[model samples]
Target: MLQKFQVNLMASKLLWTIFMGLLIPTSYSVFFNTTTLLEWSLFSISSTPIMLTLILDPLGLMFSCSVLMISANVLKFSTIYMKEDKFINRFTVLVLMFVLSMNMLIFLPHLMMLLLGWDGLGIVSFILVIYYQNPKSLAAGMITALTNRIGDVMLLLAIAWTLNQGHWNILHMWMLDENMYQVLTITLAAMTKSAQMPFSSWLPAAMAAPTPVSALVHSSTLVTAGVFLLIRFYPFMSSAWWFTPLLLLTAVSTTLMAGLSATTECDMKKIIALSTLSQLGMMMAAMGMGMVHLAYFHMITHALFKALLFVCAGSFIHSHMHSQDLRWMGNLANQMPATSSCLVMANLALCGFPFMSGFYSKDMIVEASMFYQHNLLMVTLMLVAMGLTSFYSTRFSLCVVWGTNNCNPYIYLEESNPLTSPMLTLASMSVISGAIIMWVAPLKQEMMLIPMYQKLMPLILVLLGASLAWLISATKQKNESMLMQTQINHYASCMMWFLIPLSSQFPMKLPMYLSHNYLKLMDQSWLEALSGQGINSLSVKSSNILMSASKPMPVNYLMMSSMLGLMIMMVMF
Candidate 1:
């Protein structure tokens, strides 16, 4: 009966989510012509009014709708995925909290309110990441939380800097010159959340969480928080002279780095995660080009397909008894046709196949880059990153779905309703979201009379990448020796160019060394001796001397009695 009640409760929650998901888009369409900015003053800090303001602009509504739709699907999916867990209730609550936090982040324009959502995401995500209670999960959770905390601290710093303007609402303070520090710090904060180059390791490591969490938090909502923040802050950042170049450099580097890493990754989820990193870099690059609308479009479309990909991968992993290594997966198209089909569609979308969701935004981003007089190196890197995205995605599909059947015959692959339902929804969105988003949020590109080569650059690079992937796949079967021969290259690619190890080692090592040397040596030894132990010893010694001095001494008592008598006589006189 209790179990039945739990099931019913979960179903009701899912129904409510679906209702909200459907309601948002409908309401958004009806109110499409209107832009509403609502603010309620929460309190005053000194003389500055800290307000909770919500902006219902087209962008915010679209993103909020996407978050809700995806979240609803994730919740429904989790009901089945987490059915057997004893702590399903706790998990459900956390997922709901995550959803709510993302909603807060999406709608709220105030930095203070945004921080509430931002910190909520960080804390909730940390709990979710470490839900498994293993060492790897714990470590991953620590890294995820700590990395996000850096972003959180930066947000706080931005808030502190914003206080100089005597307002917490970012929209009111549009003058860029006054808030350059705040803008820069906020961008840096967003970079950490989005898992840009230096902070990229945690995204892959965070795969230690449950697949449902991965599908919801890492893939769709949480990771995109940074992009969303940047999209909102685009106006302020536009006038900053140094912001664009710095962002472009970082985004392009991250794009290339993550693409290379994905190609060598063996873990199925991590490959997808790295691909996400690469796509985010692309989005950031687009933003750097001052194409905020285009970046927003890509973000929405990417969320749909990326979530779908993660869900399909989760199903695959669950069927394979939680084995996530792609080497162990092959010919799944024959075994799990429905799931494999979804995987293929998601992959094709990711590769930016023609007319697909990814293509709509990705093609535009490339074209827009060409239209703008960008640095040649930047343009080349962007194009190469696109190709590498296709290459790794194709490589992944070949190994996991279409290659030889590598699993044992005895292993059973289940295709249940709960597993396929959410994926089907996402797959449908992956197919059509590009057109829907483009139609809704139409971005006008300048008609630049560029050469055919310039316009066809993205498609050409994609084909090249596809061909290379095929060649590599074909060669891999014939001669495993090739990879063995190029040991150095293999290691570098596998280690993500040593970025992972360096990020992991340096942050931990330096802090630990400082803690041991400074904390233990100075704080524990010297400070403790002087302030704690030494002070206690001195007090004890002083007490002992005072005790000895006052220990019923006849002279001392007589002197005290005589002084008291003399004082009493003086008072009487």
Candidate 2:
């Protein structure tokens, strides 16, 4: 126990120190409106400097600071959360590696070196996801790893395609002869990593991991890696005429899908996971609209709140005997006051409550996006997604309040320092980080000149969504009603419009089915009989005949053999 405390204490201090160090310089960079790109010339190839570049710009440093702060708190939180587990040290090491991978991604801008972080995120995430080592965890890990491999392959192709350019740095890409292929591949890679449409099945399934892992991976490490990648490439990728439309479709589809799914989700972790998907789409949509800074700004703000939400969720889950279903949770607000308050703050931030951290970024992104887009259908859908975000948050709160079907009346909440400390730390940031970030980040203020009614749309959407959720909760205590009441409707929305099966399972079904049949029809049938049983039986029979002939060969068998040979020879003559 003492050892755990000491290790976490030292680690947290180290991370916090590093975070502060980065934060100071990043603040100075933003304040002075300066950008620094330091390159070390490793060697020269064809007179082209094969240099290694480090990006110390406001974006990367600020993100790195956010990641480090969150990591420090999460490590502190995990010390208590996994207290009963025997292998807590292993967990600590894995979390550290996860943070290391993310930092690698943040500082390194060279495409070749970027894979050190990109693939590291995938590998470490898979290991962390399957840390529990059960069948379900293994399945989730496979889905996560396999789905991400698509992006990795596309990234490799992008790298190879740019190999002729003599350098793989982001700044050097503008000089390429043809960049569309690289853009397409890189976009595809980002979509998979960010869990965009058709590649989003693994995001919710990733809840198989521990809550701390979920907080880190879902918030700012694994899933956000894609958004960061696109941000690094946006100046170039968006120049392609088709990039915006493609990204828009991917982003909006993911947003709508995740929004719909979250409203119907029963699992608390899965609900938050879906919300992460929703926010990732928001970032992607902001990127799609050519608002790179806005997307990044939202990423930072979302990371703060989402990490808090997961910590709070972890506390509730720990209090509830590890049951994750909303129907099984109740009275947490009364029992775990601090954690529950933090939970409320996180959800309110998610709904873009007035002047909160999320409001600064999410509202601005949506408003600026709506202002830029002329399409009425897309605008309505975006509003629907915004509305659904509130609806699900309200539904979640309602269920948490009323749920008692699976709760133990005698259970006590453990609101220890390890639990409440991280929650409060993140909660404070989630509330005010937006304003702080706005002041410190490069874009001090963004002026969007949208009309008043459209600008008021977000408030209207929130009120209507919350009202709808209250109505549903009041009317459907025993029998639930949803946006769609039919069996098919419920299934469609809950399954993310059948994306789970299509993206994760459908691709492997044919190959697995063929292998199953081959085992049954070939390996177990004639092949098994002939190569296994038949050969064994034939060897047995031949051994018996040899045994019988061996004894007779000493006496009468020799005379018989000689007579037989002589008779055969005379007959042939």
Each model's C-alpha lDDT?
0.84, 0.85
Cα displacement (Å) at residue 409, model 2: 1.1
Which stretch of 10 consecutive residues in model 1 shows the poorest summed lDDT? 476-485
User: What shift in Å separates residue 324 of candidate 2 from its native position after superposition?
Assistant: 0.6
lDDT by residue (90-189, candidate 2, tens digit) is: 7877888899999989898998788988999999999999999899999999999999999999999999888777778986577344878989899999
Q: For candidate 1, write residues 294-393 as lDDT tens digits.
A: 8888998999999999888988888887899888889988899999999999998998899889999999899988887888899899999999998888
Off by over 4 Å in 1: 1-31, 176-178, 444-449, 478-485, 517-573
The most accurate candidate by TM-score is 2
Number of colliding residue pairs in each model: 0, 0
Q: Considering only N, C-alpha and C atoms within 3 Å, which residue pairs clash in candidate 2?
A: none
Cα error of candidate 1 at position 570, Å: 35
